[model samples]
Target: MAEPYYITTAIHYPNGKPHIGHAYETIAADVAARFQRMRGRKVRFQTGTDEHGLKMAQKARDLGITPRALADEMSSHFRVLFDRLNISYDRFFRTTEDEHHRASQAIWLAMEKSGDLYLDRYEGWYSVRDEAYYDESELTEGEGDEKLSPQGTPVEWTVEESWFFRLSKYQEPLLRFYRDNPEFVRPATRFNEVRSFVERGLRDLSVSRTSFDWGVRVPGTEDHVMYVWVDALTNYLTGLGYPDETEDFATFWPADVHLIGKDIVRFHAVYWPAFLMSAGLPLPKAIFGHGFLLNRGQKESKSLGNVTDPHELADRFGVDQLRYFLLREFTFGQDGSYSVEAIVNRSNSELANSFGNLAQRTLSLIFKNCDGVVPPISGHTDADTALFGHVDRVIFQEMPANYDTLAFAQALEAWIGAVYACNAYIDEQAPWALRKTDFERMQTVLATLYIVIAQLAVAVQPVMPETSAKLLDAMGLASELRDFEGIRSHWYPQLAESDFRLVKPKGLFPRIEMPAEADA
Candidate 1:
């Protein structure tokens, strides 16, 4: 087995239904996990719901159910959506899990023993919607001078006896850490923003709450529950079986990356590292703060009443098409706008037209002209050799790098270029025309085309898994063809100068019926 690689998505709070923004981050992390696994890494991908918070408690109370009951219901919904999106999470933990509770308390005890935790009274602006405490300066003037949280959530004065983390003590340490390890936070601009915030100054953070009972209880205290953010962030460690020092814990203690939305950068980049430092644990390798999904060119949020359900969108467009549109339609680590029109355009133009058409046309020609089998390569011209070389240079080398760096769009663009190259080669070679005259040359052309299509089918599996798997299956490729090694061998004995059986080819992506609003 390869070295262990651990990665996580920010746990979604179970107080509200999931939206496109939530799906975007989860999908991004899923792609990364799939990529890591295909690279032969032992990958542990953890994702689930944060089931403890004031919002959840209130949501539960309003529904006439206990918080735990409500958590079970809401968490299941999130899981169903994940299942629909085919998120291959290794563990779907809930904050209410006994293991998570133990992990949270153990970490709290370590921080307390390290002199980082103290009982104190907190009086500040709090946004239950965000489940965060904000400094007064972090508040901005709202309509009629009603102050609002930076997220525009209405902030109310919250005062309680709580436990505080020695975040102020770690300001210089965090600054030094950032300077020494520039990659701890990603997308240089976001890292710079975090550095600037630290430079401005840090304050001790309230780590436990007396006001909310729906949280992890403090280790030595009964009246206080750990702050929701504190409990939620510790889910990463819990998933790794931390505090007990098991083999899994030792293997994956420092996560490869914490894939998170930009809105939570402060929590993960600032407080999370400090908490780990206080506990004398290694920090994660990276915290990637990717930008949000925009709805109709605006930030997607519950308050805006513009949250698009991912299932609804996936229902209209296929799961793979929606997945392709998300990763391909925009640059990773940057805000991306989405609409029905954009999805339709990308699906019809790229998936249905570029990739699907290329597959169908070539597969049909080979099946009809070459007797529905992989024809033998009798010869190769320089142009034919160069076409295959392009796949080696671009698809095999650069595309993987793009995936490693979370350059989803760049990677897809490269893979699509390879697809187009194959299509252009077939057009230039005119396999159909040659089949009527120069049968041997036509056979060589068809064989080369089959090889290129197989490469693409494997290349896109990380994002469009089901679709790619179907294409590979129809091509009589093995299930083991997902790895780069399998792809590197040009799919091996299956391509070794012999005729192979092929399942009937079908269109991989059917063009969508564009909604009328897309025209706008």
Candidate 2:
């Protein structure tokens, strides 16, 4: 049986329509899930909207709609975008679902039964935009002497009757867990930040709110709803049929990774684990706080008039091109910027001109000169052997190592390096030039290229699923032979010996044009 692997993207808050950042995070998570599946894991991937929150209530009021209506409408946009981007999520969890509400209540009751819950009068600064409470020490002064959250979102003094969780009581236990599991938080920097915050000290956390009734209602309480984070965080479990100890819950609980944005590291790394500890549930294996995606060195904002619609970008640049550029252009867990020119240039230069050209030319040669049949390898020269070794090192060792560490840019860099080696091999071998002078040698060269090209297609499936599928299908590769392990089998020799004939090849990555305004 394949080992089970569970991964999730932070369920996006749906106060507004989805943005490029939402698309970026989900796409990266999708890639990770796909990669794990490619490695023969039983992968369960989850992503969805966090629908019950003060932000949702406020947005609905501002738009003269009920929160449920707003959530339904806005959540569809995110679902549409993910569908368009080919996100292979096992579950699209919504907090408003009855099952999720039951899961949230059950977790709250578990913590309550554990003596970690108490009613209290709460007074603190809270950011509605962030849905987070902040200590005075963490607040900074903004214009007009206004207090702001650490993220620069405005905060207001809040006082209400609430139910508090004994977060402070678990501080030492959490520290011990961190000490034992050094890799619980990723990138080293985010882990240090989380440890620093915990070392500073923790206060009892407000887990229920009386001010808003738009969230999961606290058990047996008519007026107070469970705090948004409590409801929001339980979503990870809800998708797996949690609180019932179902087969899925037993198999896929304690997720392999929770892929979230950097801004929410504290909520995931600190509050979430503390909640689970109180509930006597196991913690997730890791929390990876990935960096933001900036638009041309500036964070996208409506006030800045530069909030790019991810749908428009995907439509304009092609889904695979956009997916390739996002992973290729940026290091995971570090902030990266993108522009129209950058996307277009990277796609055209690397995907279109380099790898795409290599595949097209090699297959076109086989289709036209070799009479549409996969040519036989009469023999291999030193150049062919060297090319094979380089590609093997990349596809087998370097790329997998980088991907395991979530170093996506590094993995793709190794992949492109292999692509360059193939291009160089083809140029030096001059398979086209040898078509007449040495037809047998030419056949060997084309066969070698064909084998390596199929290997490249299989290797790149996680990043560019559709594009890779197009190339592999065009080359008549079998579905079962598309995985990493399956690609390494003796199928290539069998394929060449078979009667499968090559059809005219079509280009996969066409050059993307920069818009006039983008050039300006």
Candidate 3:
């Protein structure tokens, strides 16, 4: 039996309204899950909101509602958005849920059993707004501008009762982990940052806060609730049925990946694994720290009034269009700015012009020339042979390898080149024009075009699901056309002969128009 693959998105902190950043990470995780499924792996994709935290307590106070009520309401909004975006997550685990609370306490108790917990009085620069405590060196002194915190939040001194985790004890072990499994933390930059931080010596981190009572109580300590990061990270294993049943734990305990944002690399890459190791549990296979999405030149900060609502974008451009634009706009692991013009340009030029056009023209020619029937493979030319070989090599060989690296954009570009080549093949062969005079020659060209598209649809489906579905439907193609290995083998398979369905091809992506003054 093959090993089951498991992955998770960081359980989002429900401090306030979620924005595009939340949607972006969720979508990225969804793609990984969907891709693994296409590769024939049994996958568990877990995502949820972090409900218990200092920010939740503050948000509740501001709104004059109980923290439970606020978390309950905001959790619905996240669920609605994920549904709207068509993000197919296997399990959604909330931090406030009973399973999570149980697992959170269990981990704490286990650490206590391991002698990794201690009673400590913490007097440090804490940003209640950030739900994080910082060292004195991390804080700046004085004024509106000079007192900016690391996340650009203003700093304040907080002295409180706290329970500390002996994170310092595991620093050397974590360094050894990196030395042994170098791929544990990804993007190299994130790995290097974690290594440098450990090299500087780990601090015994405050694992609970006495100032707030909205979170999980440090096991046996009623005055202190678990720190938000520690509480939130436990949701991954909690969703896997950890500290509960052994069957689900046995299958998916060591997750294949933890897809997270660059901001919390330390929490996931350093502290999360350390907690698991302390409990004698296995660590996740990889922690991929992806970059943030920026607006124009500045980071998209909600306080600065720069947050963009993802619903508004999804409404304007369709969901998969937004998905395609995001994946294509930037190389993964790099910050990319979002712009209306940029989204529209990619939709029209890349999707509509390049991909949709090829599908439309090819299917149209097939209907016109071959009596709307998918033709049999017969005559072979140098161009036909070369393109088929390229398809075989990419889908069967190259793409499977790149999937491990999570390079979907690179794979998409390669498939786009194949689409372009198929269009160029159409122009050179002129199958529609040659149909009346040379019937056999026309059949060969149409067969090649159809086969090329069948391969393209399978490869591109994880990126643009809706468009790929429509293309296959129009060709009277089987759903098996969506299978990764199925479409890759041969150019012509025994496709079912259905009724001649003439789909009046609507443009999958329409171009965007901008004002002249805005260009300046």
Candidate 4:
């Protein structure tokens, strides 16, 4: 049996429409999930909306709608966007789901049984925009003497009767865990930040709120609702049928990684683990907090009137094109900037002119010169052997190693290197010229190109699933032979022996034109 691998995205807070940041994180998670499946892992991927919070409540009141009505409307937009981006999440979890409520309450009861829960009067600086409480030490001054959270969001003094979790009780344990498992958080910078925060003394955390009713109701309490983070984080366990310990929970608990934006690393790294420990559940293996996506080097914000709708971007640039550009243009753990020109340039140069052209040229050669049939390799030249070696090393070894570590840019960089190698090899070999000078040699060259082109398609499936599938299908490659192992098999010679005929190929990536405004 394949080893089970589970991954999740931070459930998005759907108080607003989905933006490019949401699209970036979920698409990256989907890439990882698809990559794991390509490696023969039993993968369970989850993403969804965190619909219960003070933020949602306020947004609903402003619109004169009930929170449920607001949640329903906003959650569907997220779902539609994820679908549009071809996100292959196994479960689109919602905090409003009944099972999720039960799961959250069950975990609450477990923590209560563990004596980590107690009633208390809570007074603190809270950021409604962040849905987080801030320590006085963590607050800063804003305009007109207003207080702000570290994220520069407005903070107000909030005082209420609340339920507290003994977060301080797990302070030493959390530090010890960090010390023992240094890789619990990713991108060393985030790990360092999380560690420094935990090293400082932990105060008891406000786990329930009395001021807001738009949240998960506490297990045995009528008036208090669970803190938004508590309810939101439980969606991970809820997706796996947590309280029941069903087959999914038994098989895929202790998620391999939680892919989230860098802004929330503190909650996932510190509070989430402590909550799991309090509830006697195993902590997830890793937390990777990736950086943000910027618009032309500036953060996108509604106030700036530059917040880009991801759906619009997807419509303008193809879905796979956007997916490829996001992963390729940025180092995985660092912030990246994108613009219309950047997208168009990257897509045209890498996808359209390079890999897409390589496939189109190779397949077109076979269609015209080899009578639209799979051509057999009559002999191999030194150049052919060299091309094969380079491509095999990249596709089979380097790409996978980088991808395993979530080094998406590096992996794609290596992939494009291999593509360039093939393009160079094709040009030098001049298979078209070989048609008159030597027919068999032309067949041999075209055959070699065909094999590597198919391999490249298989290698790129995780990033560009639709485009890769279209290219591979046009080449008459079997659907079953599209994985890492399957691509490296001797299926190529067998394919050539079979009487499979290829159709004239359509270009997978058309050159994207820069919008006139972008040119300006």
Model 2, C-alpha of 377: deviation from truth (Å): 0.8
Off by over 4 Å in 3: 141-146, 489-491, 496-506, 512-520
What value does the lDDT take at residue 203 in candidate 4? Answer: 95
Give the worst 10-residue stretch by lDDT in candidate 3: 491-500
Cα error of candidate 3 at position 469, Å: 1.7
TM-score for every candidate vs. truth?
0.97, 0.99, 0.95, 0.99
Candidate 1 Cα misplacement greater than 4 A, ranges: 302-305, 490-499, 517-520
In model 4, the runs with Cα more than 4 Å from the true position are none
lDDT of 3: 0.80
lDDT of residue 423 for candidate 3: 73
Instruction: List, residue by residue over 99-207, the lDDT tens digit for candidate 4.
Output: 9999999999999999999998999899999999999999888999899898889999999999999999999999999989989999999999998898888999998
Better of 1 and 3 by lDDT: 1
The lowest-lDDT stretch of 10 consecutive residues in candidate 2 is 399-408
Tell me the tens digit of each residue's lDDT in model 1 across 1-520: 6889898999998787787877888999999999988999999999999999899988988999999999998889999999999999999878889999999999999898899988889998889888888889889988996789877888889888988999999999999999999988888899999999999999889887787698898977998998898889999999888778788888887999999988899999999999999999998889999988888799866678887999999999999999989999889999999888889988998889988998898889877876787787776899899999998777679889999999999999998888888878978989889978999998888888888888888888889999988888788787776678887874544554456676567899988998766664
Cα error, residue 133 of model 3, in Å, equals 2.0
Candidate 3 residue-wise lDDT at 310: 87
RMSD of 2: 0.8
Residue 183 error, candidate 3, Å: 1.0
